[model samples]
Target: MLAESPPETEQSAPPPVARPRHAARAAGLLIALAVLALVAVASIAVGAKPMSLDEVWHGLFHYSGTVNDVVVRDLRVPRTVLGVLVGLGLGLSGAVMQALTRNPLAEPGILGVNAGAAAAVVSAISFFGAATLDEFIWWAFLGAAVVSAAVYALGGSRSATPVRLALAGTAATAALVGYINAVQLMDTKALDKLRFWTVGSLASATMDTVEQVAPFLLLGVVLALTLGRPLNAMAMGDDTARALGAHLTRTRILSMTAITLLCGAATAACGPIAFVGLMVPHLARLVTGPDMRWVLAYSAVLSPVLLLGADVIGRVVTRPSELQVGIVTALIGGPVFIYLVRRKRMAQL
Candidate 1:
């Protein structure tokens, strides 16, 4: 009788890939890391002033407060470090979000973090007279955190579904973006202060900014990398995920927490960079297949490459006058967005 009662218990788990495929994926991941390292070096050495390799080396290891040293040590170094951190954060958050929502277009912004941070930063400049990057960063993080919590609650809290969360985020983003526009238009004096922050850039980064964001970024990275298993189960559908003993509610909560940490710190550090989150995960999934674990690994490694590469291009394209990294990424991300929309069915999660 006990044996006969188990007919319904035979649902299969997602099958593992063959060992050969695993080895190939691992090789690709290592190559991605190599690209990331090279991009980071380019970020430090190829800014507007264009330091040489020797200068970059001395700036990192030996410093004498010379002009080149200052440029290398004080400016490009922080920018490069922040770029990598922000890129990693965005990539991981994006990949995790797509996995959580099972929506091809899901990104960190889908939770309203970008809108929330923007609104808060605007308010700080317009209402609170917060003029410095220091002031805006704190307000941005606070706003992102609060709005994310609100969106979670609005989305149904413990019982939240992907559709509900997406709807809630859209609603919240619309409301906050409207508020930001009204405030900025009414208070044109604040526009100058808000303009660069809103559009996003890493030019304002300092060592202090790096210190402020490192802890949250590290924690978020760890949390996200660990979610590959449950997220993989989740990809198999909710009923199947439950059958596989995945803790759906806890996973959702943790996922949101990681997003808030990663996206909030990243936005606060360097405004809100676009497309790194939106596009990087899709690219990662393309290379790593549908396996959430490998996709996440690739996303983490490759996201920084896209971001810092964009940052370097932004520096060189305009000669003495550089474009913002945000602008550069937008220019790139727009075509990708169109391509995604035109496709009949996007590459699966």
Candidate 2:
């Protein structure tokens, strides 16, 4: 036999853990982008007066004086852009809310951010006659801030739990909604105006609205991403996170600020669209594992896909009469949410 080498000393080799998480995230992101592209193309091609793909492509790139060019540029373009912005804001805000509360079900709507923004807008419209978009922005921001403070105050203790925050948010939402309904009952004109807004449409989006809200969205996205590392640390439990050198109070405050600005600006721009915030983060987590960094990034990409797809669906299903994006999302998200609940997967967070 060939001289056997002396027994090799055992060197510890790191275990080869599965790379499923990274691969899954990459695949999910690719899927999201593909869906977004498909929706955008469909949105341009399927409308009251349908356009050929060639026409749509030419209009988008070359700006030929075609019917598709006018429709895509003037109408669908603004709506699509607004959808992306709003989705990004909602997705990021939702992820932040879930992290802060340590609750998978935590969303802007669940935590009263949307209601607060809506209440502020209604008040501004009713009291100040703020017919313009610019006038409503500040009021919405104030409302979001006040409501967030109230939620924190009501639920926050030396140690607050997700259940407590949810309860407080529920109570606050019910009271605010009652007040809004009362106002609507008393003022038919306000009701008429609010009806369109409460349903959430991107039809009114303008370049000015986009510009006004972009800064907030950009800041919120940055803050949300920055907080991801801290959020992951915090998920290990507050005491553990503290031991790991995470500043609990600062993280919470910063997360709240980011969410408030994002949700408020989105609400101000497009009214209070729902479900994207609630659903997208959970979906992202399912795909990306529990790591907040990947979850946040995936949510940022995927949320727009859902919103734009819903918008496109809304545009097509009714032919000339389009459905509101809010309605479509609620319709689609409700069943998916129920399925998640039934599977008991929603509580994983």
**Highest-lDDT candidate:** 1
Taken over the whole model, the C-alpha lDDT of each candidate is: 0.83, 0.81
Model 1 TM-score is 0.85
Record all residue pairs in model 1 with backbone atoms less than 3 Å apart, i.e. clashing: none
Query: Top model by TM-score, which number?
Result: 2
Query: Candidate 2 has what TM-score?
Result: 0.88
lDDT of 2 by residue, 206-324 (tens): 77788888888888888888998999998888899999999999998899889988998999998878778879988887677788998999899888888888887887889788888
Model 1 Cα lDDT, one tens digit per residue, 1-349 = 5565444445453346676788899999989999999898889889888667898899878999999999998999899999999999999988888888776766656568777987888888888888765676678778877887888689786466656776898899889878988998999898876677777898888988899888888899999999999999998888999999999999988998888788878887787777788798888777887888998899998889998999999999998878999899989987986677578765445
Runs with alpha carbons beyond 4 Å of true place in candidate 1: 1-17, 129-138, 145-175
TM-score of each: 0.85, 0.88
Local distance difference test, candidate 1: 0.83
